[model samples]
Target: MLLALLALAAWRAWVWWEAREPADHAPAADVRIEALNDRISALRGDLRAQAQRIQQADATNRVLRDELLGMGQRAALIEDSIARWSDPDRHGAQALRLDEAELLLAMGQQRLLIAGDLDGARRAYTLAGGVLSGVDDPAFLSLRQVLVQERAALDELGDDPRVRALARLQAFTSELDRPTDAVPVASAPADASWWRRAFSTVFDIQPRHRSLAVRPADRGDAMAGLQLELTLARAAAERRDVEAWRTALTRADAWLQRLWAPSPELQGRRDALAALAALPLSPELATLGSTLEQLRQLRSVRQEP
Candidate 1:
């Protein structure tokens, strides 16, 4: 369109020059035509320069578009790699390390809070310490401290007089299998000849020097009394009644001493009971509940997105 317009303007200039040309001012008309041609040439050059610039700009845009696509592909690859690294099933290095810690924490919580297994809980806490040792993130610092505090609490429980006495007393109950004052009669010796055994049995006779062993008609009453004492001790321990527990232990000890012969194990148990009874019975530890709750809260917050 610009070229067409330039052509039209040139035609009009030529007609005007022809009309004014009366064989005079021929040189001036030629000069005006040359000037117009030069202006048209300059205008054409400017249009070409603009077109080249536009082409260069389009090429640059394509390069930029391709770069963006390559970048998108690279970004997708990176995202996939990250997902694989963090996936729980994959158990990548970091994931496995963290999972061990979490599992230990969960186990500890389950044992201490639900099952009331102090030994199991302590083991879990110890395992957690090993797992968490490698973790340096500030986010887990509180959890680590809580675990330490919990382990310490368990240690304190181990030292608690009431708990110790209860455990020992419970063990002692199983050891009371021997009836203190009771003895079993020996069976008669077998006779070499059937006739001789028959004759001895028929006469209900033995050697004149052989002594008869005495057997109780029934020892149910004695067994019942012992069982009752043991039950009372266990119940007292469960109730955390220090006085009742002591009384029950004392009665049971006296009953055993009266009926049974003293043995090494029995002596050891008595000594342990005496030592435990001497120490002041500690009240239930309230710190564990609050510590566990704090740990649970921390775990939940850390799990949040």
Candidate 2:
């Protein structure tokens, strides 16, 4: 019974030791848990700071993206300005060509209307067409067609009227320069009486119906007058003065009639003069300056803002 009582006391002592050991470890566990809690708080703070830094970086990225876009737009604008400054007259050559074409067209109209130079006017029109053809713009393409039609109109005129008139005048002048045949005088027979021969030589008798012969001095003066009239007609033709040309030709015809006896050759010369007077000095072309007008309109439109 004493041994059993000693065992019971030992068991109670062991139980008391176990319970005191737990109480001794409790403070260390509290210290470790507090340390862990502090570490978790520090981690949470770091996480929040990292999230704030990410938000700030996103805002900075957005600002940088907008700035980059603005910079790109500015760069594009600057490039365009540089290009404009570098080549101020990008269409200078074309403008010069258009000017040349306009000048040529105006020259053609003046040549045809004022100088009666059909060949010169035709050549000017052709050169204008060539200049217009060199233009690269499609807007002026119709001008080329108009120019072509003008050229065709010139072609339809055939030979130059001034040239024809001048040629005819030249031929007539050459004919006038030729020596005219003198009238043959009848002589008395070889076997006639001396008195009859003497009378024939002393007194020349002609048919009453025969016209009076012109003296050499009068013939020369008349020829000069006719030549002056012919020259006036030619000048009028060159100047494309229809009224002046007709008046001069009419005066020349009158002079011709007064100077020369009525004959086949004389009539032919009169007919030629009449024909030259009838020839047109300046032919009317409906579409002569249409191309130039159209080109000017196109230029004006292009120049507008």
Candidate 3:
């Protein structure tokens, strides 16, 4: 306002001076020149203020843009995490990760107990329990619950406790969640020799003493893996997803066939596989003979055990 008023006053003074009849033309020219300079000066000052305002606005806009970009990135990450949690393929992977985490917790607590770190062991076991909360895969659930118990036991036992408290494995759990699809390893239960009867009771399996007649040397081997594959093959049978069924069947058969096929050099595993394969398929066994044959042919063309 002051600059505008100054400009107006200067213009009026110049005009009045011009309107006054001066004898010399030089006086009139000098008055006109001074008025032109004042107008230029005012224009320059307005342009400088406008430039500063523009720069400030640009800086503000840049900050806003950076903030918006950060928000977008955060949203994208959340979407990816949601997708992973809900994906069918990821169900198995998530379960696997949780299983690993539980095992780690157990091992950590066991160490703490050994080191005489009772409180640390207690916290570790608690965290381990939390990791498997709400998880319902039967085999894994059983094992996870076992781990929870193990954690508590570790807390109960003080440093270098009697008989290494875990020696009996009453609280031991296996990594397997469900009975495997393929074949069961005859002997290896999740608990070492320490916790046999207790584990069977907890998992609702027949007593080890009784199963001994049927169990093989590698009972707990990849029995779960094999059984799972067989189940997958059976599931595909409904849709007659022949190729997929064949893939699964072939995988199961090949695993068994590899055990005790013709080559005596690798006799033991081949023998086990043959025995397992010879057993009659359960009532839920699929009737996809052609699919099974296709798998056999594929395996045959590849290599024998």
Query: In terms of TM-score, how similar is model 3 to the real structure?
Result: 0.29
Poorly placed runs, candidate 2 (over 4 Å): 1-96, 116-120, 181-213, 262-265
Q: If ranked by lDDT, best first, what sequence of candidates would result?
A: 2, 1, 3
Which candidate leads in TM-score?
2
Model 3: how far residue 262 lies from native, Å: 70
Given candidate 3, what's the lDDT at residue 96? 62
Give the higher-TM-score candidate: 1 or 2. 2
Write one digit per residue (lDDT tens) for candidate 3, span 1-305: 99999999999999888876565677889999999999999999999999999999999999999999999999998887887677643467545656455465655544453344455656665665666565554535454545545554554455432223222111111222444333333343566566664464444344443322233444444454456766675555434354665576557555444332233432444443344333322111122122223323433443222
Model 2, position 294: C-alpha lDDT score:
86
In candidate 1, stretches whose alpha carbon ends up further than 4 angstroms from where it belongs are 1-95, 113-116, 159-163, 166-223, 229-284, 289-299, 302-305
Taken over the whole model, the C-alpha lDDT of each candidate is 0.65, 0.81, 0.51
Per-residue CA lDDT of candidate 1, range 65-127, in tens? 999999999999898788766765435554466677677767766766544567787787788
Work out the TM-score per prediction.
0.36, 0.53, 0.29
C-alpha-based local distance difference test score of model 1: 0.65
Residue 237's C-alpha lDDT in candidate 3? Answer: 44
Candidate 2 residue 152 Cα shift, in angstroms, is 2.3
RMSD of every prediction: 22.1, 23.6, 28.0
